[model samples]
Target: MDTSKATGNNAPRNLTKGEATRRRILDAARKVFSENPYHAASVRMVGKAGGFDHPIIHYYFPKKAGLFECVMEEHVVEFRTFMEHWFDGLDAYTTDKGLAVFIERIIAFHIANKDLFRTLMQNTAHVENFDQFPASAQYEVFHDSFLKTFRKKVHHNASDEEVSKFVYSFTVLAANYLGASSTYARFLGMEGECDAYWDWVKETIHYLFLPRMEKIIFDSESK
Candidate 1:
């Protein structure tokens, strides 16, 4: 069988109409999954959101899992591109600036795709074994590069396991913040504008988390 043409990112490019319908379903699925747990989300709901019949969803994605997998695959592609661009210039920044940039980019991406991030986080929390997923394999390459940069710039003594834990924690923290922006705004008695909240988050990460990590690195080195 003939394959689709490759896009700039090397993924198989879909034809115009096929791509449009696929994106519609994917967008609807993302909203559904973000709002409802994986088990609770239904193809009918996705169809309704996309203004299509359930049969269309079934045509594009034989099962809900297949649709979810496509969502993850798309996210992996975008994320890998983002990481590649960020990592390429990471060495140019000082430790403080590097951390700031990292936090900023992470938060920005999460906010831009808040629903998708929420869905991914929910899947991660419920799924027992992510290793079986092909998307996870692709992500591991970026993860390794991130760890290499982390070790080179900040914590030379930190093992891969330790760095992985830190990366996981940082990502979860950022994702949760973006996922619960309205709730946090209410708690803080602040305006609900995302730009303002993002500014506050960046400052908090820079001043609070960044300093604490830097201090820990300093203390460890002094030992």
Candidate 2:
């Protein structure tokens, strides 16, 4: 084997000790936080999960809140990137067609980041100073990006605030439906029936919001 050749351009770069440790801690903390709510999660739990001591964890993250914020910041960037990719590729010429595709993309996005979705949904109400997190700022960026993509698809002109409200309503519904799937399944008795559950979601939107959405997409007189 040519060991020296292995270190050429195709070779993987190595992380510094501090970077490696921080990565490990972040990975462990993400899992721990995903499985438990924020109030229930602790720095010690993250440290133990990553096979590090209190000092090591503290050296990287001085506070549990800060550590959680870091995890959100990292994961939300990935989320926004996923959204941008889909938004950029949108080719639908009509609002309804574009929305149909966007709905499917939203479902896939939540499924791909189920862990982060669960963590964020579970911890949102419990955390203090929630608006100060980096994820909040990143969220605004993606929110505008979503609106910009959606705007071109609308049949009629709608104010940004109006479009924002309409989009936010559906997004929250999708988030809760998937983020708390277990509860919905158990309570609704749709266990092991993922397709049916999703169909119900679509049906709900179609029946309840379709009229309002139509008005927004087609009614030019609406102000």
Candidate 3:
């Protein structure tokens, strides 16, 4: 809270002091959490990175868990926007086009916000982020869209329990990969190239994963 601590354009307090301070803290936290994962992130460090004193961090987030919740809340909003914009007409989708778009959108979201997703995965510990994430409008958007679309598609072929398990498996696979991606970067050999990541995910989604999963889910009884 000390005016003396902030430097440069972050000088002291700006007009929207509260919002600016919150943004700065979140930005700093994103950087730290991205590099260190959830466990290593510290309030004091995020505060200092934001050009503020330690007390300010506590004043905003109260606890490390609370800060983590904020970060997830922000990202869930961004992700929900992407989903709603892309996953429209879920009821109309009977072909692979919808599923393909859904998968691509999710993968793109993961790539674009790898830092935030990394933090979330480390903290979530193989849980559905929606399960552990605090209740928010953003959560509602994602939860509803995903559940509705999934339930619709798998309705005739599988029981509700089966569908639920399937969804959990799917989410866990993606979340776990995102969590452990740093360790696999060399095999991925992306070297921080977004293109490489996309290429890998694109192939994984379409040729490798989609057809096989579709048959297992939609064609099991026919065979």
Which candidate achieves the best TM-score against the true structure?
Answer: 2
Cα-based lDDT for every prediction: 0.65, 0.66, 0.60
TM-score of each model, in listed order: 0.73, 0.74, 0.68
Q: Which structure is stronger by lDDT: 1 or 2?
A: 2
The segments of candidate 3 whose C-alpha lies over 4 angstroms from its true place after superposition are 1-15, 89-94, 126-145, 152-157, 216-223
- List model 1 lDDT by residue over 1-223, tens digit each: 1111211343345559988888789988878877776767799999998899889888889988788777766766666555544444544766577667767767766655567566655555665576765246534544565565556655445556656677666666765666667777777778874677877877776676665455444335335
Minimal lDDT window, size 10, model 2: 1-10
Model 1: CA > 4 A from native: 1-16, 124-155, 215-223
Candidate 3, position 68, lDDT: 66
TM-score of 3: 0.68
* Number of colliding residue pairs in each model: 0, 0, 0
Cα RMSD for predicted model 1 = 7.1
lDDT (10s digit) by residue, model 2, range 1-223: 1111111132224989888788899889988888788778888898888887867898888888788878878666666556555554334434455455555666666555666567766765665875865356644554565566567644556677888888777666766777677777777788743867766655565566657766775564334
The candidates, ranked best first by lDDT, are: 2, 1, 3
The residue-level lDDT of candidate 2 at 32 comes to 89
- Candidate 3 weakest ten by summed lDDT: 1-10
